[model samples]
Target: MTKPIKILSFNIQSGMGMDNRRSLSRIAWVIKCSGADLVGLQETDKYMKRSCFSSQARKLARLLGMHYVFGGACKPAFFSRFGNTILSKYPIKGHKNTLLPGTGEQRALLDVLININNKKIRFCNTHLGLSTSSRQKQVNKIIELLGEIQLPTILTGDFNTTPNDPVIEQLRACLERKSVSTESKNNDLKTYPSDRPSEKLDYIFLSAHWKEICQTTLPGQASDHLPLLAAARFIS
Candidate 1:
């Protein structure tokens, strides 16, 4: 059997409605269409009590028919009203939320270890701070966390920076491969400002252990940014 893994990464924008519109259903459908084996989401929110709080990672996971891990990067719960989430078809063996310290706002790095056909892989998902300075700190924490894992790595989420930026450079410095475009029509799918996307804020990166066969950006949206998906194989 082929040991190929399909992964998707998205920034959902928390399904917020400035026009008083909620579109979680729409977001879910777009994700389903991607046919990804695993998904990394940003800006997922949920309401705990009276206060509108939560990053709806669990709900989205259920909708996708997958298991999930929510990483609390900023606060104990809902500091930024959002956090990172990972939905996977493989069984999760381990997970941790790595916190990034900075003055602007709290950020998160979610790490999950999963077993697929007995092959263990480590998946990292996160949404970085907007400011360049904040991202440097977050990225450093990720590099540190990655050093502890022996499984193949797959990192995904809204970087809030472009491929040419310094932060992305740092990410590429460690990761073996990065997805720029896709054949699944998900390539160059700019996701920011639902009205019109100009910035490429999402990604799915791979380690040297994985061989990428195809990549694409899906068309359509339930959030401000579109999703990125990639098809990869374990290098023989």
Candidate 2:
């Protein structure tokens, strides 16, 4: 029998905590405390000045003792790769980084294939653009990509929009997936502006094929956005 999988989605803001201090160790500690098997991280840095020129993803993965892959969206000086990442306890069977359609800045979707109890599952990590129009196109592209994959998938990230946004509606129309937390609950439990969160910018959307066992947001000042933890089982 396959065991339930614990997942975490966090926008580490380049490892900058609420105190405006950068610490990858603190970010790793938050993720570790969540007890997640697969973690999707956004706003990660690679040799960037913000995080002391360290590869935030690699360092966090090493700290947590997990395999990791990073997707670069923007290179400030064409030297550092900054974007999203996926850290997994299971070996990554395969992976891909896709650039999303947008004009504000280059955004990407990082997909990793991992096996759980011999069953293949796809974990997608991404951080969408902040504009309304760009986000609309980006969401369309994401849905289009999901349509091509047959494996069970878990899409997690900071969408920068509320749960009622039309973008969310479009994604639901295509993937038929549901956010781990209910819309009302998400509104009540804002995740942004860690000091006084009042926005629902983060999410973990699971395909209809997966069964959600539990979902909750973790309290923290490690980053501006609080991390979300969820437990689920594949419905195979």
Candidate 3:
């Protein structure tokens, strides 16, 4: 029997906490404490001035002793870039970044294939556009990509929308929402504005090959958005 894999998704806002302090170590601590086997992060900086030129993905990977891959959403500028990342305790076999169609702040979908306990799984991480139309287009692209892969997949990110939105409904049609546990009584899964969350912008979706064991939101001020942790096992 395979043990359940713990997955986490977080928008670290470049490691800037609600208290206005940028600390990659602090962000790493939150992820470490979650005991996540796979992690997807958004708004990570790489050699960017604002975040003190730190490669947030590399820093966190080193801090947690995990393998990582970063996909730059923004155009390169003097060796600096910003985008999404995937960190895995398992070996990452291959990875790529696909640019999503959007007007402002170029978004990207980071796709990676990981070998977990001899079973291969596709892990995708993304941060969608703020506009509804843009999100719709991005979602379509994501769906198209999912159709091309036959392996079990897990998608995670800050969707920038609530559960009631039509986009969420569209995604739920193809992938199962595994972040919300039926056994848990907590109805509110809001993750934005870490200080006082009112919106549920973060999410985790899985393919039919997996079964959800449990899920929960972690309490922390390491980033503006709270982290979501979910545990799931392969159905086979």
Among residues 3 or more apart in sequence or in different chains, the pairs in candidate 3 whose N, CA or C atoms overlap within 3 Å are none
Where does candidate 1 have its weakest 10-residue lDDT segment?
A: 178-187
Over the stretch 1-236, how does candidate 3's per-residue lDDT look in tens digits? 46889999999999889999889989998999999999999999999989788888998999999999999999558999999999999999999899999788899999999998788999999999999999999999999888844688899999999887888777766775443333223337889888899888998887777777877899989998999988888877
Question: Against the correct fold, how does model 1 do in TM-score?
Answer: 0.85
All candidates' TM-scores? 0.85, 0.94, 0.94
Q: Relative to the unseen true structure, what is the C-alpha lDDT of residue 51 in candidate 3, on a scale of 0 to 100?
A: 76
Tens digits of lDDT, candidate 1, 4-62: 68898888766653354566667778878888888998777645331245447767777
Cα lDDT for residue 110, candidate 3: 99
Task: Tell me which of candidates 1 and 2 scores higher on TM-score.
Answer: 2
CA lDDT scores, all candidates in order: 0.74, 0.85, 0.88
Once fitted onto the true fold, the runs of candidate 2 whose alpha carbons sit more than 4 angstroms away are 177-187
* Each model's total of backbone clashes: 17, 0, 0
lDDT of 1: 0.74
- Which residue pairs come into collision in candidate 2? none
